[model samples]
Target: VESATRTAIEAIRTGIGTKPETEIADATEAEAPVREVISLLGIIDGAESDILVPDADDKCPGGYFHCNTTAQCVPQRANCDGSVDCDDASDEVNCVNEVDAKYWDHLYRKQPFGRHDNLRIGECLWPNENFSCPCRGDEILCRFQQLTDIPERLPQHDLATLDLTGNNFETIHETFFSELPDVDSLVLKFCSIREIASHAFDRLADNPLRTLYMDDNKLPHLPEHFFPEGNQLSILILARNHLHHLKRSDFLNLQKLQELDLRGNRIGNFEAEVFARLPNLEVLYLNENHLKRLDPDRFPRTLLNLHTLSLAYNQIEDIAANTFPFPRLRYLFLAGNRLSHIRDETFCNLSNLQGLHLNENRIEGFDLEAFACLKNLSSLLLTGNRFQTLDSRVLKNLTSLDYIYFSWFHLCSAAMNVRVCDPHGDGISSKLHLLDNQILRGS
Candidate 1:
């Protein structure tokens, strides 16, 4: 490979020497990046030959082996089959015995039986060539490899991202990601992961890893210190899992997390002060869970930076007073729940909220001052509820409302000052005015 690179560089020098002085100077002034090809040299007669000329700059694509001595690109499966594929016979030189090959097959699929050198693709060189994982730029993408364990042989230097989605790691042992310390983003989505050992993520302490995605797994609960102390994780997604409950220590050290998605889990409740340590949390998704109530104890007062909180499609039957302690909350989703009433103090502290979603509930009535504190609420969704009548005075204080939705067209009459009201006239109503259904009016 080195000789091939030198020959290419010398050819460029010779070409430049034959060019005009002005042309050579113009070429030197240009700063275009050049990719030198170092494999598969053509013969002098302009005919393809079987002779393999090694080039240092060229690399094989994934699923192919690079024969260094001959610069030949052969299929990876052709190695160690007792065949002389390469001109230098590098493929069959490191063949292992049949007995050892069977032993290493389940542990390291491509080692001992074949070559164990680093796999090269483009400019990225990964430490292991077993799984055929390709590296693009600084990302090592090993998605859908059905890997049972974490890839232990990673490049020594820090990587930017590693995606190992759709594997089968039933349990994540301790120090799962310690091999690549400085990886900023790690995606392990759809890995069928069942349990994560305690201190599994302890190596992320003071590291630059910002995003972690372990959604679509079978995690029953979060291990203690799931995120190490002083870690820099920003976005964490554990959605579509089997998390049954939460504890305060499960999130002890994640002070920098901004978004925490626990949606589509089986979480029924959380311990007190469970989220008190996450002071910077802005977006929390607990939708499609089994939460039955919301009280001050479960949601502490330390969530000062929370902006969007989703509790949609849960089993929430009650929302105690002062449930939302976030001062700057903008959007709150409570749709598809079992709440039957909107009390006066249910949303008293959400003075800065702009959107409120209470659709698809069992709401029957609201207190006179239910929305008096929502002065900045611009969007309200009350559709798919069981409410029969809505008083205009209940929504009078919402002067900034731009849109409101309801199941019946008649409810739009009570939405005063709202610029847009949905269900402009169902089959039984008209745009001019609401049609009070006889069944709902007890006719």
Candidate 2:
């Protein structure tokens, strides 16, 4: 049998060219016993004949060995058996073996594993290879290094959070966000993004983007359709921009928007219709603007959901009657303006207003009816105004008022009347100084 197998292997080696290393090791170790067994089974027809086998030369073909044990004396290579022996270049080539899938998977994972530690990010520079670095659990931090434009392909296919802060981006291109596959939270603060191309955020319209922060940039105007259609965005921060006038349609598409910050701008006029679209808006900050007057009709009736309105350090002089259309406003600030007087019906529509600030104005006197509608008013600030006298009847309706600033007002007539009408008349009399209408202090 061994002789027949060796002969078959020699034929296969002649057919193929090279022998495999694994087959050579198997053939040398399992040869002597196979030859003895083949001789006893009468398989070696030329066993007595001295067949001289030549040494394996450089030109000898290499393959597998086959034997005659009713196992068919076909060459191991021809039968696809993974073994080879014979020195004359037999039993070596074309061996088939099954490879494990898990081995290949592990090799793939290790090759691309440590490459992410060398990633350097900034602004406009895109990574050369498509990869992701996991922060904490599944969050991704994809910052470019001085990236002026957006990358063509995103690193990961499923990202829950993305942070692109602190870059050299001057404008947000329409294709800048094309690589983000499934983002939930996107933060773009301090990216030096000055301009936003029209429909720059159109790619994320149908995506599951929930929170967006773009504060501390040079955005001058927000286009009408900047947000994607049917967006689910809830919080948007656009503070510290160059915005002057906000159109009514600026926030019309953000139906689920809740909080917005537009402070520190040159906003002079706000159309009441501008806020009518933000039905869910609760807090609005408009401090440090150039507002001079507040028109009652310009405020949307839907703003009744608003709780806080900040108009500090403006050039305001007039607030039309029922100007505050919000019914649930709890805090209203009108400080640092040029207001001289507040009309009686100024706060008539604010039924739930609790805190009112009119400090640092030019108010000379307040009528009783001016505070009649503020039944729930608690903290009132009249400081830094030109109040020469306090009308006793003006404060009678403000029974809920706890804090008062009557220090700056000249108390001449109010004190004199209290002394003249004193019923206990022990001795205190109303002393009048001859100079101007000044009341003399009692010695």
Candidate 3:
């Protein structure tokens, strides 16, 4: 009886021999029935058992056994493996596992090149092990991949640059940059990368990483530790990233961050401590945001080394008293905003501010003390706003003010006072239109 059962088992096993072309199809066909039996025994190893079991059963008759070994069978869930498998159920798909393993191994192998190689270049549309190239001494360009995840390995090209622009990459993993150890410049423009996971650039410690282009990514917010640990980062471009607010902790570690491009975002407000952390920060681009107010104390007290600040195209209604904390801020742009009023102490601490742009705003009134602290202000712009009349006090304290734009706005009062008494001044800019509880001319 045992011999007959063994022979039957061997025959069945031989009939179901492995075939690369037919393995997937046969597995699909056999999975349904075996899966049902596996479920009955509450086993998750049906795929493994089917692959690992030999073709012989020596102690059974009629090619069948009613033994009670069902209690020992263990079922494996998907993505639940604690080891390198991570997903035991995925092991059933032979082709998928092979592709994943090859790709992972290729990435792991190239990780040391980032440190040992003199130069590195990357250009990839699809992430696969078969597409890897040896390190060349030229530039690499990889744009428009529509990638939703970071690639396993950046290409290994010595003395080469990387261009990964116009993709759908949402998050960046730390290990993704293990292969580009010697990369000098990294361009990531127009990539729809929304979230940057923690330590995404930790592997770039060995590289100089001079310039990082991250424009038009539609990033709403950033994690605190987005940048790498070291301070080798010089130029960082974060333009068109829909960023609304920035906390102090967001830039705590970026001491070497020099040029920051934050153009075309939604920054309404900012904390004072946020700017104090960037001791080496020089140029800042903050144009095209939704800012409603400007509080000088909201900026850091340590931003005395700042050179340029662009605050154009915002909804800034009021410039609060004792604002403008940066004493050395050279270039300032406040264009294209809904700025209705400029209080007496608006530009208080900006002693060395050189270029001032106040164009494209709704300025109904401006107090003389608004520019009291701006001793070195060279140029001023007041164009494209709702300014009807020119208050003499607006430019009273601007002894060094050069350029002023009074093109837009409905001018009502020719002779208007630009100075107020209280630190918390009354809403004087909005009240300029109310004559008898009615709008004056173009109210």
TM-score of 3: 0.57
Decreasing lDDT order of the candidates = 1, 2, 3
Which candidate would rank higher by lDDT, 1 or 3?
1
lDDT of 3 at 86: 18
Question: What is the per-residue lDDT of model 2 for residues 1-443, given as tens digits with 9 covering 90 to 100?
Answer: 64454445544545664356576456535554544533542233433211232234422112212322222223211232233333332333422211112212212223211324455332223324444432422345546556565444554545555666666878777787776667767767678777877787887777888778776688878875688778888777776678888887787677787777677777888788788888888777777778899876767898657887778778998888878878888778777889998777788877776777787899887766777777776556666888767766665565554334334323322322211111111122211111112222112
Put down candidate 3 lDDT per residue, 232-346, tens digits, no spaces: 8877777778799887777656788887777778888887777676888877777777777777566667766777777777777777776666667777777677787777767
- Please count the clashing residue pairs in each candidate, in the order shown: 1, 20, 22
Output the better candidate (2/3) by lDDT: 2
Query: What TM-score would each prediction reach against the true structure?
Result: 0.67, 0.58, 0.57
- Misplaced by over 4 Å in model 1 are 1-132, 152-158, 427-443
Q: After superposition, how far is residue 263 of candidate 2 from its true place, in Å?
A: 0.6
How much lDDT does each candidate structure score? 0.71, 0.59, 0.56
Count of clashing pairs, candidate 3: 22
